[model samples]
Target: MITRLGLIKTSLIDYPGKVAAVLFTAGCNFYCPYCHNPELVSGPVPEDFLSMEDILRFLEKRRPVLGGVVITGGEPLLHPDIGVLTGAIRDLGLEIKIDTNGSFPAKLEQLRPDFVAMDIKTSFSNYSRVLPSGTAAEQIVRKIRESLKILIGNGIPHQLRTTIVPGIVAEEDFDMIIPEVRGADSYLLSGYRNQRTLDSSWAEVDPYPAEVLEGIAEKLRLAGVPAQIRTN
Candidate 1:
């Protein structure tokens, strides 16, 4: 079983249109400086972890009121037992939604989640900035592209997300991103929050104004991409 890092018993917005339970898994491959959940990203401390059996019992009790389960993480696909986890949740008759960084296309295809939200940090060419050094940027970008194609080709209900970080993501980056997410169900531009970020220096950086994100969304919509701005 994957380590249960944290859980929110009830969330209205985590899984669109449903009252859901949010389960956070630990560890991530990407080192995005602006990541808010630094603890989860680096892997949870042993004492802070929750047992999977305990979480399942809570979910089983709340199954009557809960509509779905959202399996999110530093990167949930990194867990080898994620399929077993999701399968258990499905057996409870609740829908499943997953949030991923798009690094594991093969695993993503196998999950076949009811809904997916893949983070497109920036253009394919700029992934090196967030990924660890010595990482094969080209191969990972190819995997991300493959993941995007899977979501689109399989007709899966998914959304592509990008956190509008001042230095990492600029307006021009979307020009490159737009084409990749053209067929996605929607493109969501989320504003960056400078609290508990992975990199301490990033905590001092100011996020783009809401109007700026609105303008970017407008441009994407005009370009035939279903775009929306989500305030953090």
Candidate 2:
């Protein structure tokens, strides 16, 4: 029973140019305060979770109209049966994109989804602040580094993302991350929304102003990084 915590029957923005269905898997290893999907992160899976059979049946019927599926989470890679879910989606002849938190490099390398969108939460130096306290910081850093290596080495159609939370991620942080992801396929910066964050205090944190985000995007573009601010 792969936990299908939430589902968006249709989405125009998840899979790049493809119209896709978004499936939310449950549980995440990280405890980023800005995470909006707290329910899927640590809360119980909602009673309305669609079973694997149910999702497959829906896909079978929608396959003719949808181009692919976007398997996101709380961190889809946290699920041990992620491969099973991806395999079933592949069997339906629709492309698959997994939105992960860049913590499961080996699993990602092995599964090889059609597209991957991983979040680079913060600079390596400030990693501990965003991740859970007392976490094995060095190990987590290594995993994210390895995931970046795998994505680039395998030439996976992927995008590296960052959410610009006002206090957690600043414009200067981009200077640290840009070099690491330099010359990658694409880099996206998303403005943080605090309305439903994992931490209640985060709800009071202000998002970066629009001009600030766009300014950083332009700076990255000028620096030769394929950077853009994702509006969706």
lDDT tens digits by residue: candidate 1, 1-232 = 4756578899998888999999989888888988888888774444666788888889999999999999998899999999989998999899999999999999999999999999999888999988987899999999999999999999989988889999998888888888888878988888888977889999999988888899889989988889888853
Query: Model 2: which residue pairs collide?
Result: none
| Superposed model 2: Cα runs more than 4 Å off | none
Looking at candidate 2, what is the lDDT of residue 139? 92
- In model 2, the Cα lDDT at residue 88 comes to 86
True-structure lDDT of candidate 1: 0.89
lDDT of 2 by residue, 1-232 (tens): 4645577999999999999999988888898887887887786887778887888999999999999999998888887888888898898999999998888998999999999998988888888867777898789989999999999887999998889888777888878887777767888989988889888989999888999889888878888878889886
